[model samples]
Target chain A: MREKQIDKLKDYKYGFTTDIENIRAPKGLNKEVIEFISKAKKEPKWMLDWRMKAFERLKNLKEPNWQKPKYPKIDYQDIYYYSAPKSASDKPKSIDELDPKLLETYKKLGIPLQEQQRLNGIAVDAVFDSVSVATTFKDKLNEVGVIFCSISEAIQKHPELVKKYLGSVIPLTDHYFATLNSAVFTDGSFVYIPPGVRCPMELSTYFRINASQTGQFERTLIIADKGSYVSYLEGCTAPMRDENQLHAANVELVALDDAEIKYSTVQNWYPGDENGKGGIYNFVTKRGLCKGINSKISWTQVETGSAITWKYPSCILQGDNSIGEFYSIAITNNHQKADTGTKMIHLGKNTKSKIISKGISAGFSDMTYRGLVDISSKAKNSTNYTQCDSLLMGNKCGAHTVPYIKNKNPESNIAHEATTSKISEEQLHYCQQRGLNPEEAVGLIVNGFCKEVLQQLPMEFAVEAQKLVGISLEGSVG
Target chain B: MLKIKNLKADIDSKSILNNFNLEIKPGEVHAIMGPNGSGKSTLSNILSGKKGYNVSGEVLFENKNLFELETEERAHKGIFLAFQYPLEIPGVNTNIFLKTSLNAIRKANGEKELDAIEFLKLVKLKAKNLKFDEEKLNRQLNVGFSGGEKKKNEILQMSILNPKLSILDETDSGLDIDALKTVADGVNSLRKKDNSFLIITHYQRLLDYIKPDYVHVLMNGKIIKSGGPELALELENKGYENFN
Candidate 1:
C-alpha cells in the first residue's frame, strides 16, 4: 500500500517577533474580565449584555471530547483576555505613524503593508497583537459604497448595521469556541456590501499573534446586502515560541437575496517544533447563511499549520434555490493533528450543495474528516454530492473519515464517495527508475492528489497553496 | 559493454537463478530464450535492482560496479529496463512524468533541463514515430491503455530516454504481429554502435523482426546452450524437451 504524506508547517517567512509596548489586562477569566474588554472597546450597553450572556453560557459548557485528536489540559485562567499594542482611542492614522517593528514584520513576510496597498490593488487590514493597525484602500472602497473596516470601528460608526447581523449566522451560543470568541474577541475585519453593488477588488486581512501568554479571539462578520457580491481572504501567521498558544476565532457570513460570497483562507499558524514541543491550538467556528432566495456561498481553505485544528466551516441553505459549496485540503505532519470538514444544511426547496475534501497525514500525526449533510423534509427534490479522499504517507500516521447524513425527505438525492490510498512503492520505483529522486516523485504524486482543490482558489493564492502543500511533507518520505 | 559473473539469486529461499553468467559486447543484440519456470524474468529484475530479491553477483556495466549504485544512479549510468508489466499511476500525467524523468537523467549528465516547449517538441516527435495517440500523453501514465499501446509506450520511452544498454524484458509478451513490427522498428531506430540490447523472449517470433547476434537457451536456474541465430530456429523446430 502506498502511504500519503501529511504536510508539515515550516518556520514560515512571516514568523518574526515584533517588539512593542503592550497594554494588557490581568490574566484569568471572569465577568470582570469580559466587562473590562467590552468597556475597553467602548461597545454599546446592548452589545456588552450579549457578550455577558455568551460568557454565562460558556461557564457551564464543557469541551467536547468526541473528536479524534487528543486534547491536553488547557489552562483557561492563565490566558490574558485582553492584550492590545497601545492606545485604544487613538489608532495609527498612517503607515508612517505605525511602529517600525510592526511595519518591518510585514515587510519580511513579503507584503509591504503600505507600498503593496497601492501597487497590488489589494485592500489589506493588518491585525497585530489584538488591534487593527491600519486598513488601506479605504478611500477607493468608500467611493464604491463598500464598508470595509475593522469590526471595532464598525461598532462605533455603524452601530445599527453591526448590531443587526453580528451573530445572525453563527450565534454566540453556537459552540464552545464561538461562545468564547464572542466574550473576548478584541479585533477582526468587518465588511458590508451595499445592495445591488459588486466590490471592485478583493478584501484581505492578515492576523498575527505576537504577545506571549495571550489567547487570540477575533470575531469576523461579513454581510452582503441583497443582490450584492464580495470576495474576502483571510491569512494568519504566528512567531515561534516554546509554549503553546490558543487561537479561537468566529467568522459569520450572511448573504441576502441573490448575493454571493466567496471566502478563502490560508492558515499557516505555527505548528510546534521538530520535537512537538510548542505550537498553536486553533479551534475556529466559521459559518455562512443563504438567507435570501437565490443566494450562494462558497468556502475554500488550505490548512497546513497548527498543532491541533478543530474547525467546521458550514453553510445553511435556507433560501429557495440557494447553493453552497466547500473545498478544502488539510495536511497534518509530524505530531500535528487536524479534525476539519464542513456541514451543509438544506432547508429550502430545490437547494444544492457540493463538498470536496482531501486529507493527507504524515509522520506520527492523525487526521479525520468529520462532516454532516442534513436535508430537512421541506427541502423537496434537493441534491447534494460529496467526495472525500485521504492519502497516507508513512506507516505511523493515520487518517479516518466520519460522515453523518440525515435525509428527512425521500425526494432528496444525496451521494457520498470516499477512498483512501497510500503512495505506492511501485509508483515510486517507476519514477526513480526514470531518474527522479524519492522527494521529487513524492512531490509530483501529492500535487496530483490536490490539483482539484487548488483549482478552486484564486489565481495567485493557488500557487502559494501548492508550494505550501509541497513544503509541508518535505522530509516525511524518500 | 556488460558482464554478469556467477549470478545466484533467490526469492523467499526458493532459488530461481543459480550461477548464471553472460557477457555482451558493444553493438551486439543478444537474445535469451527459455521455457516456463526458468530465471528469465529474475535476470531482468536483478539487473534493474528491484528490491526483495536475494541476489549475489557481480554486474559490471561501463566497467563500474553496478550493484553498489542506487536505481536512479544506475539509470544515470545508462542502464534501462523495459518492464514486462508496467505499473499504472493514476493522476500523474505522462507529459510531466516523461519531462521530469528525462531532465533527471540530463541533469545527472551535466545537461540543462528542457523547458515545456522544448520537451513537448521532443516527445511529440518520438510519440508520432511510435504511432501513439498524442491525446494519451496528456492522460495518466499507462492508465487505461490497451496492451499494444502500453508496449508501444514503453518503446517510445526507451527511444526518448536514449539509454546505452537496453534490456527488453518480454517486450513481445502481449504484442500482435502489427505491434511487434512497431515495437521492433522503435528498437531498431535506437540501435547504435556504442549501445547494446538484451531481448528476453519465450519464442523465436520476436527475433524474426529484430534479429539477434546470439541466442542462449535457459532452463531450470542456468543457461544450458549458446549458439548463433539458427539456434533459435532449431529450438523452434525441436522444443526444449530434447535439451532437458
Candidate 2:
C-alpha cells in the first residue's frame, strides 16, 4: 500500500484523457479558419473584425525568442484551432441539459457539475477542449448583478461591455503568442462585478485540454467596477500525450475607482514524461490595469506544470493612489522549464506595487524568475518592493533570477531583494531522522520556503497549491 | 534493546570503525567517552541509518536487523538520534515539525494520530517540563537559536516522540551549566524500564547528572576500557591519551 502511494505521487495523476468524440475545425490557421471559428461561435461582425485585425497583426509578429527555454518550431497550420465536445455543438441551456460525458470528465477531475456535488461557496465555469461546458450557480450570481458566463455568451448577450473592454488591458498587438491567442481564441470565462458590491462567492474557471493535435486558446476578461471587489481563480490540466500541445491564453482585468480584483491561478498542465517527450507549451499573457483612483489589483499564481512555460502576469498602474501586487510560486521538475514572474509598471503619481516570487527547480529542469519593475518619472512618491527567491534541487537543475528595475523618479523608492538557495542534505537528513519520508521532507521544506506566497492564496486554493508544490518535486530527492 | 557485534564502518574507503561491539539492554543508559576521531559519532550515524558509509555488521534492535531499515524506518521502530549539530531548517516551524514527526511515528506504529489540540497540549507540557520557552516553538525550526537552545530543542523532541532507544551524540558539548542540568533533567524524567539511552560524549560532566549504568572508554575506534560510573571519572582525570 505504501509503495503504491509513493508510485502515485511519482507520476502525474491527471494524465488520463477522456475518449469522447470531438467536433473539430479544419486543421490550420488561415483567414478561413479564423472565420470558421468566429462564425461557428455566432459572433457579431465587430468581434469577427477584431479577430481579423489580430490575425493580420499576427503575420508581422514572430514567436518570441527572448525566453530562456526554446522548443521545436510550432507548425501553426498543423494544429486544429478549435475542438469541442460533439455534444456541446449547440450549447446546453442548463446544467441539467449538459452531456453526461462532459460532466463525468469534470467530475473525474474533482469538479462535480451536479448541483448536489458542487463545491459550496464557489461558482465554477468548466472549460473543456476549446469551449466552456457548464457554469454553475448562474442564477444566484445574476440576482446580485454579477455577470458570470462564458466569453462567447458575453460577446452575444453583453456586446457593449465586451466591445468596450475586450482588448483594453492587453492589446491585439501585444506580442506574438498573445496576438495568436487574440486571433484564434475560442472560449473562456467572463466576469463582471458591478459597482458597490462585494462578490458573494469565489469565481473560478477550470480548463482541460482533452483532444489531440489541438491548440487550446482561451480568453478571460474580468472587470471590477467602482467600489466592487472580486476574487477570481484559474486552473488548467491536460491529458498526457506523445505530442506537444499549445495553450496560449490571454487574461485581462480592469479595476475602476476604489475597486479591487484578486486573481489566483493553480496551473497544473501536463509537464511531459520524465524523459521530456511531450507536454504543453504554456505561453500566456495576463495583465491588469488599475484604471481608476485608489483601485487595487493582485495576482497570485502557483505554476507547477507545463513543459515550457513563458509568461509574466503584469500590472499597469495608471491611476493615482492605485496599488498592484503579484505573489507567485513557480515549480519546475523532470525536464520542465519555466521562465515566469511579474511586471509592475507604475505610471501614476503615488502608485504602489509589490512583488514576491518563489521558484523551485528540480530534476533536469531549468527555472528562472525574470521580472521588471518600472516607476516612471511622472509617478511621484511611488514605491515598489520586490523579493525574488529561487531554490534548486541537485546539480543537474538550474535556477536564475533576472530582475529589471527602472526607477526614473528620484522621489520614489524601489527596493529589490533576491536570494538563491538549495535544500541541503543535512536538512533532509534531519527531517528523515524525524520520521518524515524523503518526499514529505522535501515538500515540507519547499512549502515553508514558499510560505509568504502561499499565504496570498485563498483558503481552498492555498491547500491545493501546497500539495502541488510537493508533488511537483517528487523523486527529485535521491 | 540494541545489540552490535563486530561492527565495522568505512566512508569513501576510509576506515572509521572496526571490531566495535556493544549491547544496550532496555532502560540502560550507557555512556561511551572518547576523544576526537574515536568513532563515537560514526557509531551513532551508522546506528541511525545515515547513508554514504560502507558498513558490515550485525546490528539488531528488538531482535530485528537494523541495517535493512531506512533512517525513517528506524525512527518508526523507536530509534531517535539527537544530532550533535541539530540542523537549522529555515521556514519550518518548530511546533509543526514536532507534530509531523510525532504523528509520523504514531501512524507507523498503528497508533491514532494526535489532533492539533492534543499535540499542542503535549508539546506545552513537555516544553514546560524541560523549562523551554514555549514561544520559540512558533518560530522556524532551530533557526537563530543559540547552541544551548538548539540542544534543548533536540531533547524536547526526544521527549515528545518518546522513542524506545535514544542516542545522544555529544549533545552536551555547547551547553552551559544551567542548560546542562535542564537537559539532564529532561533525560532523567524520560528514564523508564522500557526506554534506553546511549550517551556518546567526550566529558564526564553529563554522566555526573544522568548517571549512566556503565561507562566505556573508547580509543582508536575500539573500546579499551569499561567499568561503572567510576570509569568516567577515571578517564576524565587521566585523559584519553594517557588512559589508552
Candidate 3:
C-alpha cells in the first residue's frame, strides 16, 4: 500500500518539449565539420585558428578515466557537433520577431523572458540548442554599462574584450573535455561588469537542449573589472527523450582588484529511465582566477541531474589575501554516477579558501567527492578549511569521500573533515509523528542535511533548489 | 479513549507481544511496569504505526481502527508517541518544527493555519509555562541538549499538541528526581476529561508524581497482573519479581 506513494513520485515534470524545425550539422565530427561550424558562426580568422589548434591538440589527448565512479565510453564520431533552431539565425531584435513555438517553450519553463517582456528585476539570455534565440532587458543593462549577451555576440561586437579574456583563465590546452569544448562551443552567456560598477540585477541564462542528436558544448566567460561586482545564475533542463547525449561546457571567471563574482547554478538535465537506458553524460571544467589583491570568487551549485557527471569548479588564488569559496550539493539516484568536487590552489601569500560539499546517493547509484586544497611554498600563512558530508537514503546506494590536502608551507593551516551517514528511521519517525507525510518528512530531513550549501544560493534559486532536492530523491528509498 | 485486544507482535520471527490486551478510558492515566524486553517498547511502536513489525490485533482509538492509519494519520487523529530516545534533527529549528507540526494538526482538524505572530505567542506561553529556555526554540531540534532537556522538550511537545492519547515510553529512565517531577508536572497539567495518557516505565518512580489510577505488570509479552494504584508501591518496594 505504501509503495503507491513512491509510484506517484516517478513523473519528471520538465520532460515536455515543442516540435520545431531545427538546423543541425551532420552526425559526425571531422576537420570539415569544424570548418563548417566556424564558417557558420562567421568568426574572424584568429578565432577559427584557435579552434583548430584545440581540435588538433584534442586528437592527441585522452579522456581522464581514473575517477572512482567511472563514466561510459563516448563515441567521438557519432554526435552532431553543431545544432540550432532554423529561426535562430535571424537573431530577432525583439520578442515579436522570434518564433512563437520557441517562445511558448520558454514560457512553460517560467523563464519570464517572453511572458513579462522584461518586466522583472532579472535579465535573461535564453539559449536554445546551439544559439541564443532571445535576450531581454538589454537596454536597461546598457544604461548601467553592464554587458550581458551571448558569447558569440560578444565575440562579434566586442572582439578585444572577448579576445583578451577568453582563454586567459582556462587555456586552450586544459583537460580533454574542455579542449573539445573550446573547439566546438556554439553558444553560452557572457557578462562584463565594467570597472567600479555594481550590476543592478542578477544576470541569468536559461539553457535548454531541444535537438535529440546533438552534443551541447557551451562556453561562458565573465569578467569583473577592478572594483566591480556581479552575481550570475545559470539553469539547464532537457526533454525526456534522451538517447545518451553529451554536454561538455567550459566556464572561466576573472575577478580583478577588489572585485567579486558570485556564480550559482541549478542544473536539472534529463536522467536516464529507471533501468538507466539513456541519459546525458555531463563533463564540465570551470575555473576562476583571482588576479588582483583582495579579489573574491564564490561558486555555489546544486546538481540533481545527468546520468553521469564529472566536474570540479576550481579557484586559483593568485593574488595576496584573495579568497575562494565553494558550496556544492550533488544528489544521484537510480543508476546514476557522479564524481564531483572542487580544487583550491593557493599561489599567493595568505590566500584563503573554504569547501563545503554534501552528497546524497540512493538506488544503486555511486556518488564520490574528490577535492584538493593545495598550498604552495610561496603561499606563506595561507589558511584552508574543508568539510564534506555524505548521506545515503537506501541500502543499495554508495557514498565516498576522498579529500587531498597538500600543505607545502610551514606557516599554513589546513583542516579537513568528512562524515558518511544514512537517513535514520528515528529522524523520519520524529517528523512523521508531528503529522508530516513520508515524502514531506523526507523533504524536511534532506533540506536540513543540505542547509549548509542551500543557504549559499540566491534567494529565488535557493527555494527552487530546495524543492528540486526532494523531487530528485523521491522513490529512490526503500 | 483506546482499546486493544489480542495484540501479537514479532520481529524477525521472534515473538514480542502475544495476546496482549489493554483498555484506556478518557481522563485516566494508566501505568504499565515491565522488565527489560517484556514488549513495552514494541507495543508503543505498533501503536504509533511504525513499520517492519508483524502485528495482528484490533486497536481502536475513538471508534476507529488504529492499524488502518499511517504514522502521520495516527498523529492527526490525536495519538502522540513521545519516543524513549527523542531523535535529534540538526538544522531544523525547534520553533519552526513546532509551528509546522501545530499547523498540520490544526489543518487536519479542519482549523485555519496560524500565522507567525500567533504561533510565537502560543509557543512562548507554552515554553514559559513548562520552564523551558526560550533560546532553545531557535536552535536545532534537541541538538546538543542534555538528557533532561530532551525529555522536557518531549513534554513540551505533548503539552502544546494536546494529543487525545499520549503513549510515553520510558520518559523517566534517565531523569533525576527534580527533572522527573518536572516531567510529571507537565503531564499532570495537561490532563483533562477528553485526554488520556499511557505511561510505560521500568520503575514506579514516575507514577509517584502523575499518580496513575491503574498499574499493571507485564511479563513474557502478556499482562500477568493488574490492580489499583497500590500495586505500584507493592512492585516498587519488592521489585517486579515479587509478583512471581
How much TM-score does chain B earn in each model? 0.98, 0.99, 0.98
Q: Which of 1 and 3 is ahead in TM-score? A: 3
* Winning candidate number (lDDT): 2
Rank ordering of all candidates by DockQ, starting from the highest: 3, 2, 1
Off by over 4 Å in 3: A1-5, A115-120, B107-111
* Tens-digit lDDT track of model 2 for A1-478: 0222345236688899898888899999999999989988999999999999999999999887988998999999999999999899899888889999888888988889989999999999999988899999999999999999999999999999999999999999999988999999999999999999899999999999999999999999999999999999999999999899999999999999999999999999999998998999999999999999999999999999999998999999999999999999999988999999989999999999999999999889999899999999999999999999999899899999999999999999999998999999888888999999989899999999999999999897888888989999988886
Model 3 Cα lDDT, one tens digit per residue, A12-102 = 7778777988877777877788888887788888888889999999999998888876655788889998888888776878877899898
lDDT of 2: 0.93
- With a 3 Å backbone cut-off (N, CA, C), the pairs that clash in candidate 3 are none
| Most DockQ-accurate candidate | 3
Candidate 2 Cα RMSD (Å): 1.9
Once superposed on the true structure, which residue ranges of model 2 sit more than 4 Å away at CA?
A1-9
Label model 2 with its docking quality class.
medium
DockQ of candidate 3 relative to the true structure: 0.64
Question: lDDT score, residue B128, model 2?
Answer: 99
Candidate rank order under TM-score: 2, 3, 1
Clashes of each: 11, 0, 0
